[model samples]
Target: MRHIVIRNLGPLAEADVFLNKINIIVGPQSAGKSCLLKTACFCNWVEKRIQLSQDTDAFKENGVFENKFLEFHKLYGYVKEDSYIEYENDSMKFSYSWKTKVFDFSWKEEGRWNYVCPKISYIPAERNIVAAIPNWFEVSMKNDNIRNFMKDWQEARSVMTEDMPILNLGVSYRYDKSNNMDKVTVGDGVVLDFTNTSSGLQSLIPLLVHLEFLYTKRFNTEQSKNILRIEEEGTLISIIWNYAKNKSHGEFNIEKVYSNFTEMKRTEVFLEEPEQNLFPPTQGVLAYRLMDWARGEKGGFLFVATHSPYMVTSFLEKDNENDISLFFNKESKDGRYVVSTATEKEVQELYDYSIDLFHNLESLG
Candidate 1:
């Protein structure tokens, strides 16, 4: 398990999140749940970059460090020196000071926790927008999360085989590129046009394929190349992940691997509102499937920010209570944001609230 603590970061006045194999964050809108997840993502991204640089001089000599810090500052807006982030495990500590931009990383007995950086990803609430994309053309978006979503969507579409796990979804949609335009087929019918698919599926495909992309990466293999090249668009974290996986395997010719690559990444994904547009049963399926992926062969970390009680209670009901950590984000009477562990009874009513709405997704959701 790992621990993350944040002070004076965005709407998260003071927040602490513990990460187990599977971690969940639930709260009302504008309660700073997304803020906490994003902040943790940024810090985890940076730490892995540091680890990458430490393990390989090519990464350091190439100026990836300065580039990453400047990029993070521009993208995340590290407000002040007063705000800080601290991450730790039993044997190691990773700390950063936003005001001064200093990092301190230490391990009690060297080489104990020099683990590969988990592949990091986030599924934004706006994922459905990618399905709106036309067959041959790409959509333009300024938001980082949205851009990453589309990039992952395009990559997943380009590589997926007919037997991909996403095909198991109740209504699996496959991207057909041989058609006049990029087309999608749901079941045996004419769902080739994404506009014709249900909003629920449009939202689910990216999440499905993205996980497929990540879980397939085998960092332990003897591959000729390490990194998986993606469009230059999207988060630096993805870039860092590509670089780290490459470095972990042994040094490689950057220019040659730059254009070609193999494998999935070993990293974490921060999922926002995974329950979006999903029915209760599918919501439960998505929740359990993500956990299975997190603890699967690839084995990266998983963090979820949600409003659905089904996403919460389903895991509890699945008898994974001991392996997961749950946090409830809420604002107090005085406007201070507080995060507390959720109890089973507390989330039961919340699950009931969400389950009731599933039958009425047309009017609800």
Candidate 2:
């Protein structure tokens, strides 16, 4: 994605913003990083679910989805006692005004109307996926395409264990509301119960399941052409069975699917200070593993907001030449917060600083 300029945005008089495939925002506390993220989420939410008549008190009071134009004017320390907020996007030169509590919001371009917004999926820093899994699963299963996909998934699972012992794969809820119930396995067998696992593990199950479904769909279409050219007839079931056997060696850890979620399979992850809770190294490792899984699948993007230098250095040591961006804010002569990206040389300096701090702490012990 490209940098989107935000003029007179929250705490930012003006900024020429650009988004990287892997964008990282590094700045001191309260320097608008989180604000930028919130704004992006708000814009995305509005674009995906626009209904003028719906109640919007939550957004207005919580500051979760403020009118963009009004937000800009407020950020710039400007206000009109009677005139309603009015703002325009120069790129599209779009304009809109909301005066009465109830009003329709619309966007226009070149005297022609277009989609006012776009869809976006936001995974906040709080990482609250477990609470939303039920709804997510319901929506996925409700779609005909997704329902058929799950049926194929059941078929593949059955064929893969034709003679081998079942791993029990933990307890999972059936999508069908009529069949909505927990599945369990007794004795020495794997159980897919999210409740019994760590939060990190539970957080990744839906993403992994979705990816598995998508991969199966893509593979079927891709393999058909090759099979036709070779004058071979093979069903998706056989293809999946062989693929699973070769990939898992007949002993798959279903938990690993969530544990290794990355954007792309092999890209580097830049984490901001991840040791906030004084969490054990194991939890930290699991978090990194999940991030790596997402990276691997989606191609790695590095832009992490962190406070833990240990996490930062740990990743750096793993890949010496890996890109590391650091942010520290200082008041400019005019008394405004100025943001800057850490260069390679600057990162090296921070690395040295971190090492000294680490050794100093060790010496104290």
Per-residue C-alpha lDDT of model 2 across residues 1-365, encoded as one tens digit per residue: 32333333344333344344344454445555544443333343343323221223343443333344234212323322222322223112211222333323334423211222211223333332332343433444332222433443343322222122211333332222344422223245554433454454344333333333333332243322344323322232243345356554645433333222211122222332233343445334533543454345433344455445555555444443343334433344554444444556655655678746433322221
lDDT on C-alpha atoms for all candidate structures: 0.62, 0.36
Residue 258 accuracy (lDDT) in model 2: 20
Best by TM-score: 1
- Model 2: weakest 10-residue lDDT segment is 111-120
Clash tally for model 1:
8
- For candidate 2, what is the TM-score? 0.41
Once fitted onto the true fold, the runs of candidate 1 whose alpha carbons sit more than 4 angstroms away are 55-81, 90-92, 110-114, 135-143, 163-170, 179-182, 217-265, 343-365
| Candidate 1 residue-wise lDDT, 147-241, digit = tens | 76677667666655453434356354455657633345656654556666778777887778777766773344333433432222123335545
Q: Against the hidden true structure, what lDDT does model 2 obtain?
A: 0.36
